[model samples]
Target: MMRIGLILAGGQARRMGGIDKASAILNGRPLIHHVLERLAPQVDQVLISGRSDYGSGLTVLADRTDGPTGPAAGLHAAAKHLADVPDCGLITVPVDAPFLPLDLVERLCAGPLPAIAHAGGRMQPAFSAWTPVEVAAQLAHRPAGAGLALIQLARDANARTVAFENPGAFRNINSAEDLAAAEADVD
Candidate 1:
């Protein structure tokens, strides 16, 4: 199946003072740039799940009122965007996660149809791979008002947890402190 990557960049980022997390600079570059650099080579195509145009020329799949809210909404938008594409799967990683592993797509695809990254004994639902059809179907059953959590959707789909060794590779920039740490790590 053709694999497409989606960067979940639609968070409120309240911790980051309402700034778009994707545009937040880390090591003198936008966080999305870092994510794309690591994720682009691993998948056939990349899509951003946010309203803002980061000037990266990526197709931004914005959340829809028809779908559940939160991170799952981003997945829903992506699934709808790929509705015409047959026999394709989607691998998603958060835009804030600048240090995503290069082998993320490979590892997730190696497992079941729906697989989520598990590092440091915690499930990283945003860092997951899914069959777009299955994800859409599961999402349709969710309540659109409160918004379904990505973790709950993963559990409902019986997503396999693909264990990864390096927990740092999944580190995400949620605040200024996290960005500073990431900057230091890069330096």
Candidate 2:
């Protein structure tokens, strides 16, 4: 399947002290670098959903609607990007999670048409995939504020829930402690 990947970085970053999570340092490199390095090879193209340029040389998308929601904003923008790519799929990963699986897109694409990462007995909704056409059609009905709307959309599409063996891969760096822990994971 044709794949389009989006790094959802348009967060308010309240938990991380209002700093851009993608800019957060990990192992002396920006978290965006780590994420892009792992995710780029898994998809045909990569777009960053952020207010400012991530300085990673990838296209950046911002919330177009008047009242910006949260993750949904990025979701909308990414889905809209599908207008140019016919019959393609969109895979979204949060910018805060630098340790995403190298096979994330591969594993997600192996499941259902619209799928999500289920680890640690919880649904990692942000780490998901969707059919751009279907999501764009029903996206209007979904509240912009519903960050987990993709999970709901996945279920609505009868998506296959893929269980990841490595739960640590889904860890999100939401705080300084989380960043420190991720750094330690490397050394």
Candidate 3:
């Protein structure tokens, strides 16, 4: 099966003072660079879901629907955009998550249905692999802000959770402090 990486970069970044968390510097490189490096080779294509002006040379997709309805909107937009691809599954990752496992795509695709990472006793929904068909179906039927968390969407689609021992593998740089801590951990 073919897999495509969807890097979610549509957040308002209110917690980080309205800055683009994906462009934030970590170890002298943008956080998105780390995510791209880890995911690019594993997937057939990597698309950034959000603003088109973040950078060039990347397939940037703007959300068709308006307003911030959380990551769900971004996922729906990406699924819709890539709906034509045959046998394509989306491996979603937040742009702020720079320490994603290198084998994330492989591990998520090892199962038949969508699979998300289980770390620190929490399901990291953003780091999930979902078939475009399944996601598109949900997008069509689900109501807006119906408390449909990404995990719920995965479960309704009969998705499974892939457990990873290292919680650090899912650390997200949401704030300046989080970025510093992630850098320190890498050091």
**Root-mean-square deviation of each candidate, in angstroms?**
1.1, 2.1, 2.0
For model 3 the local lDDT of residue 19 reads 81
Clashing residue pairs in all predictions, respectively, total 0, 0, 0
lDDT of 2 at 147: 52
Per-residue C-alpha lDDT of model 2 across residues 1-187, encoded as one tens digit per residue: 7999999988888889988888989999888888888899999998888876677778888887632267767878887877777878789998888889999999899855678889998999899888777677667666555454556666776777888988999999999888987887853
104: Cα error in model 1, Å: 0.3
lDDT of 3 by residue, 1-187 (tens): 8889999998899888888888888998888888888889899989888886366488888766432267877778778788788888899999998888988999899987688888999899999999888887776766654444677788788788899888888988989888878887653
- Candidate 2 has a TM-score of 0.91
Global Cα lDDT for candidate 3: 0.82
Candidate 2 — which residues are off by over 4 angstroms?
66-68, 142-148
The true-structure Cα RMSD of candidate 2 reads 2.1
TM-score of each predicted structure versus truth: 0.97, 0.91, 0.92
lDDT per residue, candidate 1, 37-124, as tens digits? 9999999999999986599998988898888889998999899989989988899999999889989999999867799999987999
Q: Highest TM-score among the candidates is held by which one?
A: 1
lDDT of the candidates, in the order given:
0.90, 0.81, 0.82
| Global fold similarity of model 1 (TM-score) | 0.97
Highest lDDT model number: 1
